[model samples]
Target: MKVLIVEDDQFHSTFVQEALVEALPEVTEIVHAANGAIGEDEARRGEIDAIVMDLQMDQRNGIEAARSIWAERPQSRILFWSNYADDAYLRGIAHIVPEDSAYGYVLKTASRARLKLALRAVLVEGQIMVDREIHRLQRRGTSLRTRLDDSEFNVLIDLALGLQDKLIAERRGMSLRTVQNRLISLYEKLGVISEFDDEVTLNKRVRALNRALVTRTINIETLETAHRDLETWLAGR
Candidate 1:
């Protein structure tokens, strides 16, 4: 069986290559791509049987690459090897994966045995393998009570960046009152406020942001992406 490894870091790519050789005796050829853009091109060749994909890269992200790959080849098998189990990454993966695709999400910190197990499950047995922590975050993200709609999530991102209600209103093209209402909804969804709290003293916005960070709902990468987006928005305005 032929395999492809798409990772930006040389050390990690080498690690995966060595591990693949040691673990999966059936692997005959292993191809490597330095970034997601090249990985996408290589994957479209229709020669690779399975892919080991990294989440973040310079040219493109793994989700974007995988989405394009799966669009062309719906049956493509991929194993996401990432350092983050952040909600944004999980949500991106959940959004793009085909209904019947076989995939795996394993952290870089996973034990060698666990990584081998994931490889066999995805590459050989055609099964889904997700890290336990990631599975929990996925459940929470999909839960109706905890799930933030797009508008609420946007507001949360702005708030996390220390944007005021008026600024968020301007950026989102919403009335100030509407932006405030979204904040209220966001706080409720994040469990930072309650209806019975008639005499609230704590800063709801700060509390909600803190809760989100602690829960891995919004992480450093999420904020970094938001910052870039905000910069683009500001430039256009």
Candidate 2:
């Protein structure tokens, strides 16, 4: 079997390769790509049987690369090895994966035995593997009461960046009132506001931003992805 490793960090790439060697003897050909862009290019060669991919990279993100790879090869088997189980990353993966295709999502901190198990499950047995922690987050993600919708998430991001409602409305193409309404909903979802009367004394928006950051709901990677998405939208418009 031909296996490809796509990771920016050399140590992690080597770690994956070593694990693959130790676990899957059928993996006779092993190739490495330092970043998602290079990984996508290698994938276009149409020779890789499976891929072990990292979530974040310096050039392009794993989700974008995986989306591109799966777009061209719907049956492609991939195991996502990431350090973070952030909802944004999980949502990104959910949005792109091909229907009914077997894949895996495991944390980099997983034990070596577990990593080997994931490799076998994805490559040999063709099964879906999701870390228990990630599974918990995914379950919470399904509950509308616990998670923010995409629109609310956008407002959260804008708020986190210190953008006022007016500027957020201009950027997101919503009316000022709509922006404020979204902010109210976001504050509620984030538990940033306790009571209506507390809005004056408590900086609800700032508190909401801090909550989002602490909960891993928003981060630098999320911001970067949003910026790229906005650029794409602008170019298309």
Candidate 3:
């Protein structure tokens, strides 16, 4: 079987390659792509049997690349290898993954054996193998009390980036009032309104961001990624 490794870091890519060589004796050809953009191009060739995808990269992120790949080839098996188990990443993956696709999410810190197991489960056995921590976060993300829908999550990202509502609406192609409404929903789900007894006195944006950070709903990495993406968007606009 052929496998593709899509990672920015050469060391991590080699590590995964070595693990795959050790674990899957049947792996015949292993292709490598240094970033998600190149990975997407390689994947679209329709030659690879499975892919090991890194979450963050320069040209594109794993979710974006994978979404495009799945759009063309829905049956492609992919193993998401990443350092982050952030809610934003999980939500992004959930939004794009095909309903019947075989996929897995394994942390880069996972043991070699565990990585091999996940690879086999996804590529060979055609099963889903999400890390236990990611599964817990996924559950929490779907829970009604804490659930942040896609719209709310987009607003949360903008809020974390310190974008004013007007700027956010312009960036997101939504009306100012719609951005504010999403923020209100975000604040409610994050319990920001209740956390601050006097809502009139507190900055809900800051409070909600604090709550999100404390809950690991969003993190420094998520913000950094969003900031980079925002810059790219602005450059194109």
Candidate 4:
């Protein structure tokens, strides 16, 4: 499979590429771009099979690049990584690589096995692994986002990528009822409880939850410490 890395930080880009190579050496080509503008250009070329991208950049930004990729290369799988595990970026990536069709979000503090599983999922069309913390937050959201399981969260993000629920179900092996339930739960948790209305309220609630999860004002050291312990345990294997 072919892969691309679009990140501004050279050290991070190289380190991620190296780790991915060690896990999957058969990667036919691994292209690296330092900014979103170039990444968008490479994506429009339609040669890449998969992408492992960064969330932040000086120009074009990962969110905008992801939007372009979704429109141009709907077939490719994507794995988005960032130090910030905020839902804003998570939802941003969902716009390109739907949860069911080979996509994931990982925090920089994630374990090696988590990264391994994320790449493997996109490559093999199995389950995409996201940051465990992100998963917890997805479940905590009050809107259509909270009702989704990890798999559903993946599909919902994929929906943000312009996929229909029917298509997402076929890709993820889930039923339509399952999908609707997830959406209902998400809306209730997100405080947009009026299912009858699909207006600005829903959008506002979603944005609020996404912001709460991603752009936090509180200390995350406790969560960071927990992740560190988990990483130590996983790497020991």
Q: Which candidate's TM-score is highest? A: 2
TM-score, prediction 2: 0.78
| Tens-digit per-residue lDDT, 130-188, candidate 2 | 87877775677546686899888888877776678877887889999999999888888
Clashing residue pairs in all predictions, respectively, total 0, 0, 0, 11
Candidate 3, lDDT over the whole model: 0.85
Residue-level lDDT tens digits of model 4 in 1-237: 778899999888878887788778768788998987899888778488888878777766666676678677666677878887565455445544643466778877777777776777765564566768777764564344343345545544444434566755655568987766665555454444654465434453344345334534111322332234335544774
Off by over 4 Å in 1: 136-183, 191-215, 219-237
lDDT of 1 by residue, 158-199 (tens): 999989999999998999999989988878888888733777
**Candidate 3 lDDT trough over 10 residues, lowest sum:** 133-142
The whole-model lDDT of each prediction reads 0.85, 0.84, 0.85, 0.63
Q: After superposition, how far is residue 214 of candidate 2 from its true place, in Å?
A: 2.8
C-alpha root-mean-square deviation, each candidate: 5.3, 3.8, 4.5, 13.6
CA shift at 223, candidate 3, in angstroms?
A: 8.1
Q: Flag clash pairs in model 3.
A: none
